[model samples]
Target chain A: MIEQDWIWGLVGGLMIGSAAALYLLVNGRIMGASGIIGGLVDRSGWEGGTERAAFLAGLVLVPMLVVPLYETVETHITSNLAVVIVAGLLVGVGTRLANGCTSGHGVCGISRLSLRGIVATVFYLLGGALVMALARHVLGVI
Target chain B: MLRLLSALVAGGLFGAGLLVSGMVDTTKVQGWLDVFGDWNPTLAFVLGGAIVPMAIAWRVAERRKVAVLGGPLPLMTEGEARPGRNLIIGSTVFGAGWALAGLCPGPALASLTFGGTGGIVFVVAMAAGMLAAPPIRARLDRMQPA
Candidate 1:
């Protein structure tokens, strides 16, 4: 896709990993994006609300500041209105039900070799691949 | 103070990484998932690279009870670490959504500053889902008892 995408991907990956490491080592918390946000949504995270709020503020704010620096950032996300809504709903429910998302399970969970994390990662990847094949190749909806 | 600061810094760095790694690009994410079609292997590098430092951090964390800033580490007990039905079902469902939109929670939030109306819609829906999950989960647990 983009030129040298792999290089940028690698560099970005290191930054993410370093962030996770810093969160773990310094804060003593798993840097799971879903858990942080979901906790607030369900009101289960009220006890530690300030920290979660602060984290989310940065999560949202940093991109605002940094994205302007780039010439362009193309997401290529689906434009179909219904698809967007449905996908969003599913992502929310699935991640909450599973008790983690890509960050919590994929990066943080798997890093610690937790069975729950590993299993979730495998299943999600499988689910994603199956849906991709069906929707893109067969149905041609998204 | 330290806790909040660390979270802020960590969150900032994580957001930047998502942007830099091109994880915010739905096409790149979709291309990686499109294994049978024209495959893009860039995401693999992102995953592999992220795992390296995190794996090391886990090891380093294992030897310590408290974090460097004096907080309780996320110590997973045997029960907490085990996989269950919800984990399987939820992950699969999440995957379907990810495939549909080519964005996950991290990328969804990271892209919000520049993601336009679609990003806003997705985040809102995702938040709704999160709000509804507890009751649904409670019912499911009642029915399944597991």
Candidate 2:
């Protein structure tokens, strides 16, 4: 698993890291998903509606485009869609609370050397890890 | 004006690549990771998809001598270099956290968008952790020299 996964991890990591690096390289902006989405939210913030719409729309369509290629994709967990909706809401709350989401704090923020970004990323990682550990190891439930 | 437009254009392309590569799928993500049980090399295709366009982009951007977005072409991007104990301690703590949670910020967002339980949990926990940092930083900032 480790051997086959190494490249996958690299690809995943590279897929993210390189996208980030290039985004930063060309635009001088961090490709933080949360911030972009945040900008897409209500009209209260600095992000204008049109750009936000475009950004949010792109995110939605990206996944749908891939469905045709991978003919036999399988999903293991199907407990409830309600859980998924709640989770999305919770994430929205969290990203707002943290001032940025994973892409913002975890990838672009860190790459740009923002201390706040670093701190947010730490929290993001630790929080996820601890919860994962509890879910899998402690609770013994997935 | 153009900068945000450039961001949208670049992001759109990136999103398209993600779709075509199947990197957007959480099961495929985990499946690729489940190498020990039933190895999957599908990610290689994903990598190729990303790299091919990126390589072209690099060449084109170089030739153009200006960003597709506005602003001076970014020349240097050196991350922080602080000489202090605090930074080291902080980085270690963060790395430990990343190793534990496979979902980093970007992937976590991608995962959550796809409606994965673990991804949801990860995003929630991460937010809680970060929300707890500001007051701490305020206090630390008061201690640091200008």
Candidate 3:
């Protein structure tokens, strides 16, 4: 069995793209999760703090309302606290350093055909694959 | 007010997409990353699906000077869009972390409402990491040749 819902994935992706489009066309901003949050923390992009906060609030709150209507959301996060913390820190720092993430780079960046976005996406995906292979196959750590 | 509302709407939809597309599911994400194992291609679909509308949107943006809400659009200048070492290195590190946890910022936050103590811990630590990034980024910028 495939055990994956490709159709829902497509539908949801369309929604994601639409959200990005709306964000770009209406608010004139890139819908990047890390960029939005990072700006708030570093205080560099404070001019749009309210808008960022609103978007974040929506990201945090809307799931609460909608997730309950369907099957429970599940995660395969490791049980190791150290691993979780380290991973979180890495992601936070990494996205900031890169200036984008899957949303910005993977979705918006690629769609716009920006070389930077494409390159970043390729690197990240390759990195993820390498780590996944090593961790799962070689070290068996994660 | 309208700007805030638009942001909220965009965010809500984005979160919904993550949830509906199963991007919030760490196992699925990890599965996709597991090329040598039983790799799942759901993520590819999600990416493909998201790109269609966004590609159209960018085309729409190309014609407009300002956003509907009267804000300046994020249209890039010629040289400003170039990829650099930071993007490569940072994305590499991020991918490693993502492979480890199968969680990214968006899903991490969206999962917060139900991700329990573990989720809280991750978000807090991630926030700290984000706060730590500015100094690190500044240092990297300093190291670059003028």
Candidate 4:
């Protein structure tokens, strides 16, 4: 049985909020993680230098900051690097193909009540659930 | 300055929510899916907890006639149903992949805050997907009507 910690939820919310703030404050972009991470690959899309670097850096560095505070953090991921690399690549391609990443369509777009965003998000959730089922249950890949 | 501050507020709140919900962990997600094995209910609680904020936010935003995030407030637009054949096929493909990855963009970033090799890989691949999609879209768009 998996345990749910309310603290983690709160932390997640703040990170998402701070990231969103940083993105908009300096770059005028939404903190849609997909877009930010995606921008790393397509840097030309972003105009500002200090802001983009800082924003992207925050994504990478903020977690490192947590290490000192939390000391050691552990996670459950059984997939090898090769699997992750391929998955990440597929998601990058998917976001561009679908016209928005999960954060853009799922968080901001759906929150905005955009029809396109809603449709995209529904598909995303369903996709996520299906993926989990297939990987863990069907394939027995931990 | 005000715009930036407000943006910060919104994002901070969003990050906090991810932590509180335990969504930062794919194991939690996998637990939810492996109902026969572990039968995790945290996902249900998250779905439930989300309702509270959603209601409050909806009501407040409706009353204010403004989005707390600032910008032109968005209203729902119900367009004439034009569900294309491609939409169905595309959704099928997307759902399949998401089920496999468990690390969608939002959590992947938050997971990065925790700093792990898998999380890093999850994010890197997600970025690649985002980059490759556009050209594919352009190609398809060229074949279809605007």
Candidate 5:
């Protein structure tokens, strides 16, 4: 599965890029997934609530439309409830604190060569690799 | 209405892209991060692929004052251009969570319909964490004085 999927990754990535491009070109917003959700969840971005809601609706609902096109949609998430909960909290707090996530910092920020975006991406990747090493290799959990 | 529709289409495309790219797969994401074990480089392709069109879009946006649909384009504010303590700390924390679960915000949401109960739980917890962030941020700021 891993060996044959890079092509799909590339293709899907292009689609994502196109989506960001369209969002910027038409709606004039950076297609940052977490920021969009953050705004609604915290009411900080309520001014554009309708637009954000519409985007999220498409994000959650439209994927169902394409699920039938594939054979499997495996997520392989950890069965350990503790890990899931902790990870979720970290992701939530971390993204909010940083003010962006992969879409915001990694994709959109880096594309525009924003220093904050590039710096955030580097730190997060380092943090992820370090934790993966610690948990999977040293701690033997994950 | 057009703004709403455009947002919907962009989001739909983003979701579809995530599905097709296998970003929804936790093993694949973990595999990409698993340097000590079997490593998968597919995520690099995805990231690179995503940047291509977005880079072009930025260039196009440079010439335009507003979106083609008549909304203001994103202008990087002074604060956003500068990297700070929160940016590094928060990103690192976020990355740890992402690596642990093999899920990030985009894939987490995209996989909700089919990601089973675990997916739902993660989303809920993540939302809780988000709700908890402002207080944490304020506290952290007070501690560091930055």
Candidate 6:
């Protein structure tokens, strides 16, 4: 089962990479979800607002169209409401402050071997592992 | 219009990829992150799969001055590649949040149709966080030496 999961993960990841590659090669954009949405929110890259919007619209709507064809998407998000909100806020602010997220830094940045991307990936993984240890083990809050 | 279409296609493909890849499943993500528990190595494959083609794409992009749609490619100039405090601090915070929620922007948004109220809450709150960032960034910039 885990091996099957790995196969799907890899195949899916390939699709993601292709999508990003297309974004870069065709639209000439990084295809970072946070950066694209953040640019719109902060109004920093308003020049490309329409393109971003188009992309987001597709991102949102396409999944809706595809989901019905498969089994339901399941998530094991924390049951605690406060945890959810706080986590959301942190993710929000952190990605913006860091200037990228998994898509930008993790995928795009790392592929380019950009120093910022590599550094950010390391910190985020470390932070995530530490928090997971504390929250799930010590605090038992999440 | 062509550029917009291309963006739409890319976005759709990305969302589909997330769905197909099992990335939309928080349990899978949390499982992957649960290094202390029944750790799943699925995401590692995903990352490996994603990086290979993108690495190739970067190589292809190296020779291009403009995008297929005539837009400038987002290649970094030497000045933009520097690592800094923001990268470290911000990613740490983001990772903590990710660990707690088991979702990031891509999966968060892609999960909207089925992620229920939790997804909605996450997305709205994330937007608020994004909105809150510029002021914080401005302050950070001020503190930096000229």
Q: What are the TM-scores, per candidate, against the unseen true structure?
A: 0.96, 0.56, 0.95, 0.69, 0.97, 0.96
The DockQ-derived docking category for candidate 3 is: high
Number of the predicted model whose TM-score against the real structure is largest? 5
**Residue A8 alpha-carbon offset, candidate 1, angstroms:** 1.2
Instruction: Indicate the residue-level lDDT of B83 in model 2.
Output: 29
lDDT of 6 by residue, B1-146 (tens): 99889999999999988987888887787777778977889989888888888988888888886888886777744346468888888999999999889898998988888788888899889999999987887888899932
What local lDDT score does residue B31 receive in model 1, on the 0 to 100 scale?
90
Candidate 5, residues A55-111, lDDT tens digits: the string is 888889888778867787678888898999999999999999999999999999999
True contacts kept of 4: 0.37
Q: If you score just chain A, what TM-score does every candidate get?
A: 0.95, 0.75, 0.94, 0.77, 0.96, 0.95
Error of 6 at A6 (Å): 0.4
Candidate 5 regions with alpha-carbon error over 4 angstroms: A1-3, B75-79
- Tell me how much of the true interface, by contacts, candidate 6 captures: 0.84
The docking quality of candidate 5, as DockQ, is 0.85
Of the candidates numbered 2 and 4, which has the greater DockQ value? 4
Give lDDT for model 6: 0.87
Clash tally, candidates in order: 0, 5, 0, 48, 0, 0
Candidates 1 and 4 compared: the better one by lDDT is 1
Off by over 4 Å in 2: A25-28, A72-78, B1-5, B16-68, B72-146
Model 3: CA > 4 A from native: A1-4, B76-79, B142-146
| CAPRI tier of model 1 | high
Off by over 4 Å in 4: A1-31, A47-61, A71-73, B1-13, B33-37, B44-97, B142-146
Candidates 1 onward: DockQ, in order: 0.82, 0.18, 0.82, 0.34, 0.85, 0.82
Would you list the clashing residue pairs of candidate 5? none
Ten-residue region with minimum lDDT total, candidate 4 chain B: B72-81
- For each candidate in turn, the interface RMSD (Å) is 1.1, 6.9, 1.1, 4.8, 0.9, 1.1
For candidate 5, the TM-score of chain A alone versus the native chain A is 0.96
